[model samples]
Target: MLGSISLDKTTRRVSLRAKALMIFSILLAPGCLGSDEEIDVFYGEDIVPPRATPDFVLFDQNGDPVAFNDYLGDVVVVAFLFTRCPDVCPQVSANMAWIGNELGDNLGTEVHLLSITVDPWYDNSSVMQNYAYDRGLEWPHLSSDLETMEPIWRSFDVGLETYANDTDGDGTVDGFDLCPDTPEGEQTDADGCGVETQQSEGDVQTMHHPLYYIDHTTGTIIVDRAGNQRVYWGDFVWNADMVLDDIMALVEESA
Candidate 1:
């Protein structure tokens, strides 16, 4: 009986060893772990080019033609947003406003804020004017016809989608809607867009209601005085202070 038990134990040990070897072989086999080149291709990091501003021309909120070349000696922060955006767009614009206020007297002189509307058709001069006024944004809020705006959007990689919905039951579908189901007479951004804000509180029992804006991309391009595009802050993650610091650095470098 002892001899038979020893034989069974040895057989079990051999089986376990074989299984381990098979698993190792599969892991190290060709096409199993993938080649080094293939791994690099899959996991490699992208290298972004150094900032340099590109040439552009569009109409401002007043229907006045504006060109990048016109501001050859000044620094410009160009942002893409629609007047009616409910989410990140408002945040981005607000941040820009903060930056502008921080800059104070140097706004249009040393630094210029150019907000290009993604929704050109609905965001005409008057609509853009109201948006600017409501937000107290002193910068140029501009848009052009679709034919002109399409290429500009492509150049900036700004993607926008329009939908039709009558959330207010007012018998008219408004432009720039993220959630078309919202009821009418509800307070919204300049574009009559989606919900205004979102809310989240801490672990305590108290309630916290924060502003909720739309989910639009928040990419603001910073162009230096040398016409080089220096920095790009995507989404609303970047605050006014950080943007201002970079701008100051660029200004010092230019000087």
Candidate 2:
């Protein structure tokens, strides 16, 4: 596990924990911190600096346009993944869902979660909504046309997932998982779409807005109120408890 201060934008990072690949696991060096402090675990590809974030607008799952700057005053945890992600993508989003639940009432008030789709050509509005609803996510799951999202992807160095899978056991793959979050014990049609209404539909979704090519490349960026990109977690750092600790510490420090 590796953790350290990020000096500049080109800081290459690597996780200090083991990463799960397919059904096997790869043990790695541990680098988690008991307290919240600036730590860099980047292996390569230099750490992207805490520079001024450019403003970009995209339709969320609910099909509403939102500006990134609008989230400045809140603690925002952003991840790059598509609903059809087979392995790490679902794992990363599931981690965020865990965090969102743990945040309790502070979810929308003090903190927010952002999942941006790297695959736009297929992950349209409906697919985005199903992805979040199935994951018990209360945050905005975003995506857009490739032309609109190209720069956004490049800006954040988020790898595009040109493909997808049926990770939800709902029978539908990412691009076609229209009813992504079918409730457990519920029967789904030929498509993976399931009824989450009887279950928990935490937050509403928006549409047209929004990775999985690199190893342990599931990047999570925590942006503070001031928009100074604060903490950065590697692909394998999906432990909700560990992330919750770091986020809480950071929020407390900022206050």
Best by TM-score: 1
lDDT: which candidate is best? Answer: 1
lDDT of 1 by residue, 1-255 (tens): 111124454345445544543564476677787455321110111113434456777888787888987887888888988775656788888888777876666678888889998776678888898998988887889887889887776666566665554455423344443335545554443333323331123212222112222234438877778776656777646656556655554444444
Model 1 TM-score on a 0 to 1 scale: 0.61
Model 2 — which ten-residue stretch has the worst lDDT? 18-27
Each candidate's root-mean-square deviation in Å? Answer: 19.7, 13.9
Model 1, position 93, has a per-residue lDDT of 84
Q: For model 2, what is the error of residue 167's alpha carbon versus the real structure, in angstroms, after optimal superposition?
A: 23
Query: Whole-model lDDT for model 1 versus the true structure?
Result: 0.62
Q: What TM-score against the true fold does each predicted structure earn?
A: 0.61, 0.60
lDDT of each: 0.62, 0.61
The alpha-carbon root-mean-square deviation between model 1 and the true structure, to one decimal in Å, is 19.7
